[model samples]
Target chain A: MTGRHPLVGALSAVALTFLLGPILLVVGVAFTAGDTIEFPPRGLSLRWFAQALSYGPFLEALRTSLLVAMAGTVLALALGLPVALALGRGGARSRGAIGTLFTLPVVVPELVLGYALFQILMVTFRVSAFGALLAGHTVLLLPYAVRVTGSSLAQADRSLEEAARGLGAGGWATFTRVTLPVIAPGVAAACVLSLVTSFNNVPLSLLLNGPGTTTLPVAMLHHVEFAFDPLVAAVCTLLLVLAVAVMLVTERLAGFTDVFARQEADRWRP
Target chain B: MWRRRTTGLLLAPGLAVLALVFLYPVAVTLVAAPAGVDDGGLADRLGALAADEHIWRAAARTVRVAALVTALCLLLGLPVGFLISRSPPRRRAVLLALAVFPLLLSTVVRTYSWLVILGRTGLLSRALTGLGLTERPTQLLYTETAVVIGLTQLFTPLVIITAYGAFAHVHPDLEAAARGLGASAGSAFRRVALPLALPGVLVGATLVFAGAVTAFTTPLLLGGTRTPTLATLLYDYANVTVDWSSAAAVALVMTVVVLAAGALAARVPAKAAPS
Candidate 1:
């Protein structure tokens, strides 16, 4: 690429500032001593943070979000890993159709997905709210796991597996020893991405959450409806910190931007 | 033969879960779209929805907002993606990371931040007043402008990332060659780089448009009662009115629009690597 002009660089910097401005403002407002959310925060204090921790619904929602994210990530990997393996090894002809099938949930709007799942779980089967949320999240997140793991499997060197097989190793043993080790980082990336996606989800959580089983984002939405206090800012700030930490870890382990690029690339690979 | 069987065996569990949880539910909802038909059958509900001015208004508003958001993302993303792709690898990584950072936060949190920034006493108003632009704080919140801004913030990163991938595949030398052949830098980019990057731009537009139209939290918080998009309309139908059929209808509309967009995007020729 030709070197970027100074004008483009400056403009990009301004755009970045615009994108990050509101999020940083939220974090700053969380420290306000004032009851209302204010800019410059009207004298800095951690009282709102304390209140966020003490708030029962917020705490319960936090716990529920963590549990659901963890469970959903695990389930996504279980489902996605196998599919990824199958698609990777099954070769060229059927890959496009099957991959699209597995990835259908990713492109489908969350509003639609949540609406459909709500009807099935609540109206049809009468499933528990928690179970429904977990199921919804797992399906929502499965595409990420499948795409990540499938790409890794496709990119894995065939020589090592061949070498293992040449040494008289059984298929399962060779896979467990060779293929698993190579794809473990991809799986880890998938797990982290799935957790983040699940935790940050709103429409699905909103539709599936019942009394006493609301996820954090859903609770925050309901909380915002009745009140617009600094307490909510405080809670949001904590979530922001957690998100930053996770992104940092994801960057260190697997380049965060590469995930998006890889996902796009995977879709077009015939 | 054995390997194929193993693949099937491995896929069976995931497929089972997907069918039960994802596919079946969506099929059920699609089938239930005609549930409220009285005497006119499916046509009756469709006619009723078509007659409902509120639904048409909401659908039109959703399409308008989504289109505007996609246009804005494309305008902003092109330069950012070019800059990122042209930068050194380390700087490129940092820029991409910063670009995607906003996406890491929850939609509620991001939308909530906008509530503070665009509220009457929020940052934008305070800044405007501080700068003496207005005598009183303006009501930026609860406006369609707020919804557009919020959605753009939420989704622009996606455009940049996808466009960067497209730009990366375009050989840098192609632009240089064009410039060498008497084309100005701007014209060189327009003639060479832009066409090659069109596919990624289309993909990004598809995603941003779909996301903006289907977005709930941002419109709910920022647009408030003033701007009711189809997503929120569906929410009201499902939750407030307990009208599953109406909600199903809205969901189906959204799905069709999104799928159509996706199909159009797919038709864009893939990135053309310079020979």
Candidate 2:
């Protein structure tokens, strides 16, 4: 906490320069509808935003991205919940190994995952966007749901579940009535995280999201091939604001520590 | 054994789902190695990697960039983390969120943002020209430098978040104790504080290395044709040329290398930070 060294200050300054400076500068330049990526604003206009909005290709890509993200989140939640239950309650001997399997997507690079998925869907299954892109996203999102639900499960008052079972509420009813309520915060956190993750994901989406089904990030990839405008900055800024807003809301509701703690405890919980 | 069908039922479906969706992609990729362009077998892909120098060189470039990116992240993140932890609790949330900001933006967006700033007619170039810093715009956007910049921006948050956790764990009392013995403030911190923080720094560096090495968008866009990281190479194989065999080989190597390095780093003992 104590300020003492100039080396630390210099590094902070340089890091911020690389981090915040470019985005701010790009946002500033977007107002310049100067027919190119001009530095000193020739003039300010909303024409680019309008142009970008009306651009059929870009809008379609955006729609594709939203739809894919929505589908991916649902599938991931459906799949991940059981893993959370198993890992969150499994015997100690196998928990660590299962935890490793559940979290591998977060650590493994997207390029590697995407390439692998491409080979499988194309060569193995002969599946296209639906089988490839949707599955790839579902893969990416499993860990988030597992982490969220597992943490909440670990934090839930175990005695309450035991009490419910003792009263013959039965396992299904108790899970829905008791366990599910306790973990709602974690579930919410996972849902938002999964959606944002699906939205921003590029590498995996690029590989798997094919013809007539390009996601937003992949669309931006295609768009940048032909044009350079503030629209990219505008879209990025919007995504950034949305992400920060989600994290703020989720962290306030569920607590950031709880998210990771749940992940960790679920791993260690016998 | 408590024979609860409900528990078994609850766990079965989710595990099966993850195995089908998440685990299958990685599993299939590994399993893909045995097959060739013609017949699909492990011998064919391994032979391709062994025969091709292009793959080796691209991988080497990826490793170099990854190393530099990880090194830069640790160098930059440690201080920001220390400073944030030092600040009062009221401002911590904002600072932390700022650190995590770039992670949320799609890589393509971040790359385009740089495409504007680092371009010849881009904002930074214009500013440099006006300031009389150079005769003309220097090549930055389509080079290694730009890729590094984008990556450092994109992944350093992992370092900050991890380093902050490490920094937070070293109780202030430990530093106070060292200072009580009349050790200079710098010496006490260097000896007492940094050792404790090394693990977090290590974890952060590993994550950054993995992410940057396998980065696709920045190198794909900002790197131009000149820069060929492993991701770009893999992209060329699967998407551009439809060379599934070679692409699988390259991806498998990347996976082994990253996994080995991470698992090794996590276990290495040199990370001792003394109290």
Q: Clashes in each model (backbone N, CA, C under 3 Å)?
A: 0, 9
TM-score (0 to 1) of chain B, per candidate?
Answer: 0.91, 0.90
Each prediction's Cα lDDT score? 0.83, 0.73
Error of 1 at B211 (Å): 1.1
Task: Give each prediction's DockQ, rounded to 2 decimals.
Answer: 0.61, 0.50
Give the best candidate by TM-score.
1
Interface RMSD of each: 2.6, 3.5
lDDT of 2 by residue, A12-77 (tens): 667766777766666666667676766566788877667766878778888888888889899888
Taking every candidate in turn, the Cα RMSD to the unseen true structure, in Å, is 2.5, 3.0
Name model 2 segments beyond 4 Å from true. Answer: A1-10, A90-93, A255-270, B1-4, B22-25, B31-39, B269-275
Tens-digit lDDT string for candidate 1 (A189-228) = 8888888888889898888768656888989998898896
True contacts kept of each: 0.66, 0.51
TM-score of each: 0.94, 0.92
Q: Model 2: share of native contacts present?
A: 0.51
